[model samples]
Target chain A: MKAVGEESASQELQRVVGAGRRADWVMASIGLAILIVAMGTLISVFADLIHSGWPRLTDPDFYTNFPSRRASDAGILSAWVGTSLVMLVTIVIVIPLGVAGGVYLEEYAPHNWISDFIEVNVSNLAGVPSIIYGLLALGLFVYTFGMGQTVLVAGLVLALLTLPVIIVATREAIRSIPQELREAAFALGADKWQTVRLYILPAARPGILTGAIVGLARAIGETAPVITIGALTFIAFLPPAPLQSDFPYLNFEWLNAPFTVMPIQMFNWVSRPQAEFQVNAAAAGVVLMIMTLAMNGLAIYVRFRLRGRVQ
Target chain B: MTSVDAVTEDPLLVRGRIQPSAEFLTHRRLADRLARVLLAAAAAVSVLVTTGIVYVLISESAGFFAHVPLKEFLTDTEWTPVFENARYGMLPLLAGTVTIAGIALLIAVPAGLALAVYLSEYAHVTVRETIKPLLELIEGVPTVVYGYFALLFVTPLLQRIIPGLPGFNMLSPGVVMGIAILPYTASLSEDAMRAVPKALREGGYALGFSRFRVATRVVIPAALSGISAAFVLGMSRAVGETMVVAIAAGQNANFTFNPLEGAATITAYIVQISMGDLPYGSIAYQSVFAVGLVLFIMTFLFNVAGFYLRRRFREVY
Candidate 1:
């Protein structure tokens, strides 16, 4: 009886020890799998982009000329210019509105039902898919406002789509400002508006800027919304200046200026049956990725610098 | 001192500080009231945007329902939106969306959960931090990149092993979508696992329960609500994903379950219709909105459910 009891106890110990080893192995294996897959993906994207972009990088006119019908003659200069112009306009529209609204909600507005409703809706808006914004641009910007499918209308639509994200980030940043700072500003006889402008805005500038850049990156990649708003497929000319140009001014005859963006261009290229187009798509993908990465890196750097200074 | 006197004499300041006349007080109250009004107007933008989206979808879809019976739209098998004699059966598009989403979940959940468990319970701090950012890089990669990668890399690789795999099939896109969303699930699940109190793990350890057993049986179940939320959010992402399905999954609007064959999701069909030169006020054009409405409804339901789950079962500890 004593021997049997000892034997069972030792067996239980063995089982427990084995289970522990198995668990550690399983965890290690899983961690390895995730790291491997992520690394593999990053390397592959970089590799493919470089391989495809090498040829395009050699062409002297690649950065200066417009896309042409011939495969050997096509370039991305106009698309690049259009992308920059629209993105700049979108940032100009979204930053002030998003920041001011965030400040109002975080600093001035009372914690009441009205504010709560706005808050919930804002969060929900953040989750609304991008394509729906395109639909809104179609109905309101294009149809009701009659913007005539210009870059202005497209930029406005993207600004709306990115507003919620900017607002959410700005609100969080503003909320993180120390209450003591606000109290000090008020004690100095500054009114609410003065306090926000002088103390709060300067203090929260880093977070606000980071959020704006992130929002800009998101807007830049958006194709579906712009497509819905009737962004043209093949514009030969540069976008007209927003104020100086009359309604459909660059030839109202060409009011339906076929426009294309980096993402849209890449999408079109990728879907074509020819292998050359796929390679072109990969090259465009590289450009888009570089642009996105640059934006994200700048935002990250700014955030770190701001945090350091504050500390 | 002179500057201070000049500032005090400014009209806005004079209006702010004077507390004498009844008329002045009334005007001051009006100014305060106007500030509140301005704030309300600012807050109205988001609400108006949402309302506009819904109204547009509804108005366009109303025209669609008028022309095609709701029953036929819901039950029809063919989806030839381009042909003059097009059938507007939405079932096939919906089925394709669900199948792709389901397969993506199948791929993402296990890997994500396992990764979460490892990061939460096993990995060293250095490894955890390094791996976490790397995983998030997957999120940072634009969906368009994923779409091309799927078409260029994953499809070719799969064809090597899976005989009869179409160049554009559900498998590659679904798998790529799963990978794209893997970070979301893993990061969230890791948070949930970490939220399981140390005391629970200690108790299991005292009782001779192995670490793996404790993690699988105690920590995961304890964090099930959050884990489930992660899964739901992943599904929502999969359903909403457009570029991958548009590029990789062939635009054949057939109702089938095979991952190896070509398929068309609702978003893919929407992309196709939007890309072409379909005339305004045409049924083909209306169908895009109709499809958009369905997509909207599906994602909205998921979002609401996810919000509720996160609220109800969120662990304060």
Candidate 2:
């Protein structure tokens, strides 16, 4: 009877172990299925965009001509140009401001309540909806400051939007540099600015670049804030030339000119009832997606290759 | 010993050699101080942004409320601000936002958590590294593109299966938005789960626990705080999302809980008004700010809650 009981107990143990192994296999498969489903969605979206937009995407005229009532004649010249100018302004404003802010927070600020408060504010700002930034722009830039619905206002809005991203990235990059580097610089009698400028900035440059690209990629696609500030949907004329024939070769007139970005142009097309407009929207989306994905891919590559060198 | 004693005896020479000139030192010190001040001011821009957001929302909302009572704005079900018989109630938009976000969470929570678990536990390092960036690429795709996908692709597909589904129903956008937000939740939760020490997993296995059992019972519980933070942040993201809903969900402010019907969200409403030419300071214009204030408050509360959860339940280990 004792032998029989022991044999049954052994069998019971084997059965439980078998069940656990089966369960593990089931969960693993389920996880893979979820992953496949997610990837499948991404692939299908790309394929669909390509399928719909191939003709227009191939057309050279699609890149050069102004938007027209005729779907076949319509193009994204003004939209792409506006997006480029806005991005240029945004990059100019954000790099210095975001880098300085990040450097201060990570390297200079004392570990006190004021610093903590500023840190908190940065994180909170990151979570604020992109549209609310639009509202803020509509009120503050467009109304109170009276910047109007120009390229500058669009630039400023996107700059503010991109600020938190770059700052966070800058801080992370700075933080990842080993403490010994800072100590060594200090030991050599380098002051704070000298240490940061000489030792830290070069090491952290790749990471900062990655952050800037990511931030600008995000900013380029933003439509709500630009829309809220009253970007024209039907502007056939381009902003004035940046280079003048007169004494001041560089013109500021483009900054004050109204604009339309790629996404907004896409939005305009998508909203139209015509089937051909949908094709245009898809074509524009494909272009925008390429730009965004390329930037993100580059950023990832930079981080992957450079992250090890710092540590 | 004789050389050291001679050097120590020449106090004036030692002082002159050790210390730089006051003029040079003063210039360097002033430059450093100025840089510090400038950088500090740069950091303060974030604070200024927050102040600007708050002040703008409040001041504009105050103007809106002066004309329309607060009671109607909250309690009323209608939200036709541009109509001749303009009703300022925002409940329908709120309902639409909640319903879509709820559907989004339902899809994202399970899928995202599963992805997190798989990445943290099952994926090889190479696989994780390769897949993560691609997954983030899903997020890096503009929301506007997602909106187009919802309206052009998902809606058409859904119509064949769900009879009587409107062209601009909430279900498609909500689902796509879930997909859009999935990468965020998955990556963040994976980060949390990966932070859980390996010793804990080994201990579980030593106790005769299966891999699945260890992951579900031991690892998840240990990483609960971080996973919860990810969920809250994802939730906030879903609520704040504008483009997806505005494009796919119809602009009609219908007060319905069902996902089959079309409805306008708070974000969609803002976009609709902003697209048209509404002069500044008009009640119609101020109304957008009023809705924006509501949006700001909702997202603000969620962010604060997320922050609190991260801090409050943070484990030292």
Candidate 3:
């Protein structure tokens, strides 16, 4: 677009040489510094947390006992237990619905407004502030459904919160499969359902697993909706084991049991005035951080592996 | 059809036939139809969630306006919804939210852009691969944990360096919020910058521009709309950030521009109110919905703008 003659090129070379070289180099150095400092904060945050929490974390009682007025006596047994239970329920609820929704949108839904509506709304739901989900749960689950503030209700809310992500991710995974596989299946007299089940899904399994794991990771860390569901800050008792004395042994009374999760426990500690509780909060945070980052790392690894295989 | 049927009758050609037994085919068809209906119903759940959110927010907030005048809620300087002489002014909370977001953007934008530039242009594939997932490790860390980090570690650090920094100030949370959002901004903007054709870089190099100059002036300008969208989206994340501000940025609702002061956000206010057992449909209870309504409208607008900008720029490429 600019003057491109040989004379102009020489002139431009001189112009760039005089001032632009130093400025650009300075900008690049700044860019490097920015990355360093950005990552440095993460390191320092974790370092400080580990430093403060390390001594207390080694104590067995930290995970064996429950919340206590004395921070030294407080632990996270119920919190961790409840978190796993909630995550389990959420996974059970979300995977089927999310995968089905993804399958439908990718394979079955036609070029129409219902498809468009579902697609657009799902993406938008991905952007909604999770606290709004808390409000929705407060109104819908805790009151409207009369589920009370229980493990099942909390799990359902978190499931709702992550449904969009799973759906969107699953759709992306499904979309990555080649069209020819479906066509070949169809040519062999496979119906839409059979083609999807026999050909596309198996090929898409790695991608779908990647999405589901990532989505579950998010559900595990979510706090706002769980808080809104009124998980107790001082949960001294564990929910009943998901079984009974009878031969069938399956019991859902635990579903209605009050619960607390790691994040909530950490929140309670951080909010306290006591200095010891701050350390306690730090310890819990370090544990929670490890859990979340490990989940994320595994998800990323799975995704990377999938991409390698796909190509 | 006749040819296919004739082929199916031949023992040697049976395996190649498209159709199986008629009875089995009908049964499979029925199952397929039923399964399609169920899968389609699953797809409809996302729409149901959207409707449920809209219905709850609207229906609850509808009764809030009957008591608090809309003009006062918007314009009044104070927000003391729980105090005896209560003022339901949204400005104080809005100011806190905007101020934190503003401070957060000041930190995140330049850092994010720089990180994007470094990642997109400077780093090799292996280096980028390793570093990127680590950054996302930051992204995936729970906000509550970040809140704790800001409150205990950062606030103390700030106090040591900057004399008289408040115990519960906005600066730490805002800064942490920036750090929290770095991955989103960096990743999105890098995607944009990378999408700028390599020809642009070559053009700059052909014109005697250095790598840095080519990256900054050439690729960045080309991706400006997408970069701006990332910044806007990051700002939206800051505004909606809950536990960090609630934990680190003090819960006192104040009308102030100073970053050193304590203040509450719309989210914090909701959290604070929820700490109590407010009876359903009470005026105070209704106020949470009203605050959420404002928050929803604010974020919704920003998200729409970001989405539109990303789309518009995407089309150009």
**Candidate topping TM-score:** 2
TM-score on alpha carbons, each prediction: 0.88, 0.95, 0.93
Question: For candidate 1, lDDT tens digit of each residue in A1-311?
Answer: 67667688779778769978987787778777876886687788778877876777677776676766655566677777778777866888888778867877887778898887777677667767787778777767777677768767777888998898788788978878889878876675555654666677778889899888878876787777887777765666765444446664434322234456788777777888877767667777888888877887787778767874542
For model 2, residues B36-128, the per-residue Cα lDDT tens digits are 999999999999999999999999989999989999999998888889999999999999999999899888888899899988988889999
- lDDT comparing candidate 3 with the true structure: 0.84
Runs of candidate 2 exceeding 4 Å displacement: A1-9, B1-24, B312-315
List TM-scores of chain B, every candidate.
0.86, 0.92, 0.92
> How would you encode candidate 2's per-residue C-alpha lDDT over A108-168 as one tens digit per residue?
9999999988987888788899999999999999999988899999999999999999999
Off by over 4 Å in 1: A1-4, A8-18, A108-113, A186-191, A241-258, A308-311, B1-40, B125-127, B194-211, B313-315
Q: Which pairs in model 1 have colliding backbones? A: A232-A259, A234-A258, A235-A258
Query: What DockQ, on C-alphas, does every prediction get?
Result: 0.42, 0.52, 0.48
Model 3 lDDT per residue over B1-317, tens place: 12324324534333655656676667778979998999999999988887888888888888988888999999999888778998889999999999998888898888899889988887878988888888887888888989999999889999999899988999999999988898889998998998899898999989977778888789999999999999888877888889999899888899997999989998888877776777877888889888988887787777777877787677897
What is the RMSD of candidate 3? 4.3
Query: Higher-TM-score candidate among 1 and 3?
Result: 3
What is candidate 2's CA lDDT for residue A25? 89
RMSD (CA, Å), each prediction: 4.7, 4.9, 4.3
**Residue B211's C-alpha lDDT in candidate 3?**
72
